[model samples]
Target: MNYNTENLDDKRLVALYKKMLLPRLIEEKMLILLRQGKISKWFSGIGQEAIAVGVTMALNDDEYILPMHRNLGIFTTRNIPLNRLFSQWQGKASGFTKGRDRSFHFGSQEHKIVGMISHLGPQLGVADGIALASKLKHKNQVTAVFTGEGGTSEGDFHEALNVASVWQLPVLFCIENNGYGLSTPTKEQYNCEHLADRAVGYGMEAHIIDGNNIIEVYTKVQELAESIRNNPRPVLIEFKTFRMRGHEESSGTDYVPKALFETWETKDPIANFEQFLLTENILSADNIEEIKIKYTKNINDNLELSFNESKIESSEIKELNDVFNIIENEIITHSSEEKEFRFIDAISEGLKQCMERHDDLIIMGQDIAEYGGVFKITEGFLEQFGKERIRNTPICESAIIEVAMGLSIAGMKSVVEMQFADFISSGFNPVVNLLAKSYYRWGQQADVVIRMPCGGGVGAGPFHSQTNEAWFTKTPGLKVVYPAFPYDAKGLLASAVNDPNPVLFFEHKGLYRSIREDVPTDYYTLPLGKASVLKDGTEITVISYGMGLHWVLETLKQYPEISVDVIDLRTLQPLDTETMFNSVKKTGKAIILQEDSLFGSLSSEISALIMENCFEYLDAPVKRVGSLDTPIPFAKALEDQYLGESRFEAALKSLLAY
Candidate 1:
């Protein structure tokens, strides 16, 4: 309330004026274009420009921002050329997303602007990540994220707030209280007096500002951004405003009371600020008109140029880096220098080596640091790497994943361990939607690996024991790696760390300590998307991964006469078709084993692929053996039958007879 504009010289005031006006003018022209069938759609930020413009102007140039679609001022204030901004709106290949996504669904890494998704809450979580990277890198940076009043209702909003506070992350959460989210009023959204009031429970500082007052917004946000950098912590600001138009132009504002709209119109941010400039004798009538004409011509020229640009073609949409680009590193050649390592030890060594090689590599999870995680895989890692690299997190799965993405954006690689693979359900959205689609949508490589400790037989029951690799294999844009042996586990993990894409690395808890083998003592890596022929023969081929591979090998010991070619599929996503088909062609029969249930599993897809491509080479129909189609039970008797040795024996017997 005590903020003043006297200290802001005429030059700075005029610059702020231009920033607020450009977005309004561009959106006005965009509205005309939408009706003329030139642009496909539009979101108007007519009255709410001050909140976006003021806040963006308040931050340092190097600080990152994540803004929603309605924040046109954030784009305009950043000085993104009108032509290029229009080009993006017009779906031109010259735009930030290269016409991959229209509107604000794409991020511009060059501009330090992270994009928004349809689901608003997750972006708030993603902001926590960028802030974490800044803190970890020892940079004087703060991340600002925006959302509407309704967005606070989501669990992700609360989860992110709690994580940022608990970790003391430097994140400035800005909420634009635009009265309504689509059609629902703020009253219907929550019972709190103000959205900022919710910050009390999280122990986060809160502030409410007159959003329509540009001077107040700029002053308060600038102060907070500076204070937060000096003493890092999370803070929330509720900017009170109302949208002049509907959520989108097409959805008219019939739900808004006419009286309320008229009242807000009188307090219009741009108009009030202009009147202040006039009252202060900073601008005359002619000067104001000249400014409008200058901007109008600029807007017109950009719009015409954008309309002339060509649309993006499908062929130009290829991703720059291959998702499963296997690093051509030397394989384990030191046979005599090898040492016996448990499956868990191999994983730990792989991560340790990767972290040592890539200085920016970070690992995060609940109880991962100090406690060394529940399985003790990262034991003594905290003392070795320090808390900055080996970070611990709250039970905010959603936020932790987003932080990994933020690290990726900050030129760092990360490994996120899901304490239990089944717990991924709590934070699955960002993994599937944000991290997986990041590169495909905007060419931002999500250089992160998610470690999923999964599989049954440990009696952890349904919530802990799960083979979720199938879920990711079905989702394009993610690499799924499941290794059976300790050697493969270490090598495949190193390859995953090398991959510049999102990888789901599944480590079967049942094998973490139960399985041990001679692994290379020196640093080495093996290629992903390549299956190892453990035992090759001509009678029949058996394919499997993770615990299923171990089960197949153990059951085959009973029948030595059965000449079977056993294949361990190291990476499930980019299936090694060449090796699988070559082995199947010679054997003339195949049986796929999996720890996951039969239906809609990786086995189904692999079987389908084999039937489609290798029909001529097949002597009998391809068979699949998997756990029972039911939730994994805690009872020992039921779990034994579910993943029984009899199932593997039956499949081998049936395939060999063919």
Candidate 2:
């Protein structure tokens, strides 16, 4: 095909050739290493180099690009150090993630590279966050996210695209329409004629280009990128490409038809581009040989040098005390003012104070803007903070949660309000896998506080009335806070927002308007992983949090003769073991209580901790008090029986008699 080269200069063409050539050479060496059992696995981008190179070359140095596992050209194009890149592939301690995450499932904040999460769709939302940050910062920088044709079927992809289009975010969704998603053909993937056609439903501009044509990709993408930077709207570009290899080296290409490979082999990006360079007289055939020889040697040398770096010998446990340093800009009002507040009001006051202090802090969720949340937590936030800071998103819990992680990548903080604690299940993957594991896996701090309105009493039933703090408490790298009183709620929330890790802040919906205390109107931070002794006694130590603590205190008032040490575990993740242990040691008897069901509840873990740490001091076997092991019922009568006063009274008698 005769090409248009009036706008493509010679110097730029050679630079593009080198970028594309380097990855080609690197992959060639690495695949050899894979077969030799040197590198454990390889996800080769042998055929799809043009897309990564073209998209990366067009972006500004500071602009972020989230690339998939197959997009090796991106790392090479961005000049990521070959030694470390090789080290990462080899799982060495010197690698980007220091052997914490496997393969290219790692992000490099230094190089403006947000690598793909193994689950392909979530990164699209992350790209939205980076682009939103650019828009908020008024940088006008574009963020380009890459995905295959199969990834387009993911809910996150659709959610992210809708959000980007709705907000007109400067994001370029690059869909490399590779023929198959693993062994499954595109025929089974989507019914659409073209993947780019899906973008029209999202109200975004769509473009289709020949993926094997390097000149077409570079020139066209550069134009679209420049256009988005100027106008600041999303554009999805479908690069019609083919993956020449199987999903990975282990998976053979037997499923692929012979005709497809023959067709794609003729349109090989490197062969065609090299022919174009040769035909244009841009460089001699000797120059092409020299470029390949130079990088091929460089790739071998880097691979050899990287082998000298030791693999991760021993796995290190994540440090719980590695707290995020919150740089306070403005001091809170000095006046000593304490006012009566309900649990809901304290949360509102605390968030308001935090927003006032941190100008860049954003709060995102569904209907959180005009509706002020179902419980009215963010009643006037949209008006006070404006639309940008207080964002109302589509029903995209999975993507929006990672969107907070993306904000953290851009050095911003966010609070994601899950309408109900049960709804958090929708956004659970990013919390457990992506956001929660980020710091441990890659030293990337995702400073996000997820507001969870939890617990049962008002008969909201199985979905809304869940005491699910136990779900996150066991997950490493996440802080869980459940404050019983308004004072603790306000103070703990401030600390949660300021903390450098992801925190699950549980608020009992029953306690929201019912529980009242004198909470300070001024900003204050209650340190997490610290316990407060509400009452000191000698007979027994009862460690509890949230509604369970309230039940303990109330029940204790009725049992006047049975003096007990009442402890409120303000934070669930970093259990204040010191306080709980000392109390149990002093009292010589213990009981762990929680509103969750008995089996696999946080109460059982506390019982284990007491038995392990203070077994000798125990006057009797450590007792656990929890709600009945059954799903929260809808009927008020059944719920009352399930969480009845008799259940706790009986447990107290059994422990006391022992």
lDDT tens readout by residue for model 2, 301-347: 88878988765765333333333232342323324788999999999
At residue 209, candidate 1 shows an lDDT of 92
Supply the TM-score for candidate 1.
0.97
- Total backbone clashes of candidate 1, pairs 3 or more residues apart or in separate chains: 1
Model 2 score (lDDT): 0.87
For every model shown, what is its TM-score relative to the native structure? 0.97, 0.97
lDDT of 1 by residue, 1-658 (tens): 2338857898888888888988888888888888998888887788999999999999987889999989999987887778888888777877877776789888887678988988898898889888988888789788999999989899889999998999899999999999999999999999989999999999999999999889999988999999999999999999999899989989999999999999999989999888888887888889989989999999999888887887666552354343333345455433457889999999998888888878888999989998999999899889989988998898989989988888888888999999989998888999899888878777888889999999998887888888878778888789999999998888888888878889999999999999999988877888878999999799888999999988888888888888889999999977898999999899889999999988899999989988988999999999999988898899889888887445888767876776
The alpha-carbon root-mean-square deviation between model 1 and the true structure, to one decimal in Å, is 1.9
Clashing pairs in 2: none
Question: How much lDDT does candidate 1 score?
Answer: 0.87
lDDT scores of the candidates, listed in order: 0.87, 0.87
